[model samples]
Target: MAATAPKSLGAGEGAGNIGFDRSGIAGESKGLLKVLDTARKVAKSDSSVLITGESGTGKELIARAIHRNSTRRNGPMVIINCGAIPSELLESELFGHEKGAFTGAHRSRTGRFEIADNGSLFLDEIGDMSSDLQVKLLRAIQERKFERVGGTQTIAVDIRVISATNKDLAAAIKEGEFREDLYYRLNVIPIHILPLRERRDDIFPLTDYFQNNLLDRSTDYQIKQFSDQAKQVLTHYEWPGNIRELENMVERISVLVEEVDIQVHDLPECMITPSSHHTSSSVSSVFNNGIGFNEAVDQYQRSLISHALNESGWVKARAAEMLKMNRTTLVEKLKKMHIKPEMETPIF
Candidate 1:
C-alpha cells in the first residue's frame, strides 16, 4: 500500500477544490505550502510547469500531484527520466519507432508523448537531455505534433507538459549545453523546491509519516520514536540527500533497531560524530586562542558533556550512560567544569 498524505496547513482551504489533490505528499512547511499553492492554481490550466530542485527534493512528487488534480485526471500520467536513458536511444523512446526502424525492433512501439495523449507527461531530469533532442522537443511542445522515428506520419497529442530538473538550466544555456528557447518553453510555470536543510521544520513530520507507512505495511513492525538527543542530532545534521535520504534512514532504523525508542547512537555515525569540516574549524579556533593543548582538550570534554546533558534532559544517570562513565564521575566533571543546565548551546 502507498503511504497516506500527511496533513498540510491549508491544502484546499479557500480554493474549494478546484482540482487540487495533495495525495502522497507529506509536509507542512511554509516553503512547501507555497509551492503547493502555486501548483494548485496551475493544475486548472494546461500551462507547462518546470520544477527545479536538488535530486531528492521531490520535484517528481509535485509533478504527480499536479497531474492527479488536473482536468485530464482520467488519462494516464506518463513519466520518462531523460537523464537515465542513453542519448542514442532516448529519441526512439520519446517518439516511438516503426517496425524495423532500428535493431531489435520486432514491432512498432508507442512513444511516451503519444501514450500521454489528453493527459500529462512528466520529463524528469530534463536538464540532462541532449541539445539535439531539445530542438525536436521544443517543436513538439509548440505545435503539439511530432513524427515518429524513421516514420513519415505526424501524430498530434493534447498533452500537458511537466518537466523537472536538478541542474541549473540558466547556467547550462550560458555554457551552450541547453537550448535557451526550449528552457523558456518548458519553464512557463516555474516551481523551485527548496532543499531539506533549508526547510528543517518538515523533518520530524516527514519522519513520522514514513514510520506510520511502515506500521501500515506490517503487523510485526513496531513504530520507533526518536529520542530527544536523536532528534537534536537529526535537526543539526545537514541532510545532503534530502527527503529520499530521510525515508531510507527511517526504513533502516525500522529494520535494524529492535527497541521502540531510537537513541542518538542508533543513527548513522556521520550524524552523531562531528564532521571533518567542523573538526577543522575547531582545530583552527584552538590555534587562534592562546590556549595550551590541555585547555583545548578540557574545552572539548565540556562540550561533549554539555551536549550529552542536553540530550538526556539533564538527568545525571542518563547523561552518564550516554557518556559511558559513572554517574559520580560525570557529576564531578560537571562540577569541575562549572557546567550548568543553563548552557543551552552545544559548543561543538
Candidate 2:
C-alpha cells in the first residue's frame, strides 16, 4: 500500500529517537527530503521495502535509516551484496548450510537470513541475484521460513526485508533476467533516491558536513573553504559517483590542500574542465545565436573575464593572473566591455 506524503523533515531534525535518527544522511533538497519522509513512514510498517538508486547514492544508508527507525531497531541488521557473491555459493550464503552440504562446508554455517532473524535483512544489489536463486528467495520471503542447505527441517524467522539495487529490474524482468513475481514481493514499498547532480542544493551543505566532520576526527585534517569559482564548478558538474565521490573529494582536499581558501584550480581537473557534452551544447548555442564573428569573440572574452573576476572575488590582479593577462589590460577590457558582476555567466 502507498503511504501518503507527509511534511518533510529538515536535515538533522527529529534525530536521536527511534524512527528519527537520520544521523549520517545529510541534505535538505526536496528530492532527498521526500525520500526521507517516505522512509520514515515506511519504517513503522512491517511490509517489504525496495530501495532503488545509482551506485554511491547512499541506498544502503537509507536502508539503515529505515531499519534504525523501525520496530526492529534493536535487532541485528544483516546485509549481503548479491552481486559480490558467486551464484554457486549465494544460496548457502542467504539460507545457511549444514555441515557437508557443500565442499567448502567444514562445519554448519548460519546464513544471512538466519542471522538476520528478528531484524532487517538488507539484500543489496538485488538486481544481480541469480535467476535460479530467485525462486527460493521468493518462497522464503513469502512464507518467512526456509530449509537450510541439505537440511530437511524448515527454519522460521521474523524479519523485515529491505532490498536495494542500482539496476533497472523492470527491464531485467522483461528480459527474463529477473523474476516478475519476486520483484512484486520485494517492491511493496519502493523508495528511489535521486542522484547528487539532480539535488545540487545539497552539494555545499554536504561539503561543509564532510569537512567539519572529518576535522573532528583527525588532527592532521583542517577545514578548507571553497572559493566562489570552485563552488560554481562543483554546482555545474555532474556527480556520476554521487555522495561517496563528494565525500572522498572533501577528505582528499582536506588532507592535501594547505590553503584555507580553496581556489578553482585546487579542484580536480575533470571538474574544472568542461565535459564534451557541455562543451558541445555551449558551442552549439553560440553558433545558433547567429551573432557576428567579432561580436562572438567579444562575448567569449567577456565570459572568460567575468568568470575569472568572479573566481578572484573581483580582485583585478588575481583575475589577471588567472587569465594570464596584465592587470591594466584586464581592467581596460572590463571597462570597455561594460562588464559587471551581475552579468557574469559561466560558459564552462
Q: Write the per-residue lDDT of candidate 1 for residues 1-348, one digit (tens) a residue.
A: 233453343345423343467766777777788888899989999999999999799998899989988899899999999999999899889989899888888899899999999999999999999999999999999999999888899999999999999999999999999999999999999999988866777898789877875333455566677876577557655677999999989988888888888887788766655655655555654554345689678767866888789789999999999999999999999888777773432333
CA lDDT scores, all candidates in order: 0.82, 0.82
Q: RMSD, each candidate, Å? A: 8.0, 8.8
Q: What is the lDDT of residue 188 in candidate 2?
A: 99
Candidate 2 ranges with C-alpha deviation above 4 Å = 1-19, 215-222, 279-348
> Taking the tens digit of each residue's C-alpha lDDT, what string does model 2 give over 223-251?
67776657766765677789999998888
Q: Cα lDDT of model 2 overall?
A: 0.82
Please report the candidate that would top TM-score against the real structure. Answer: 2
Candidate 2 has what TM-score? Answer: 0.79
Clashes of each: 0, 1
Worst 10 residues of 2 by lDDT: 1-10
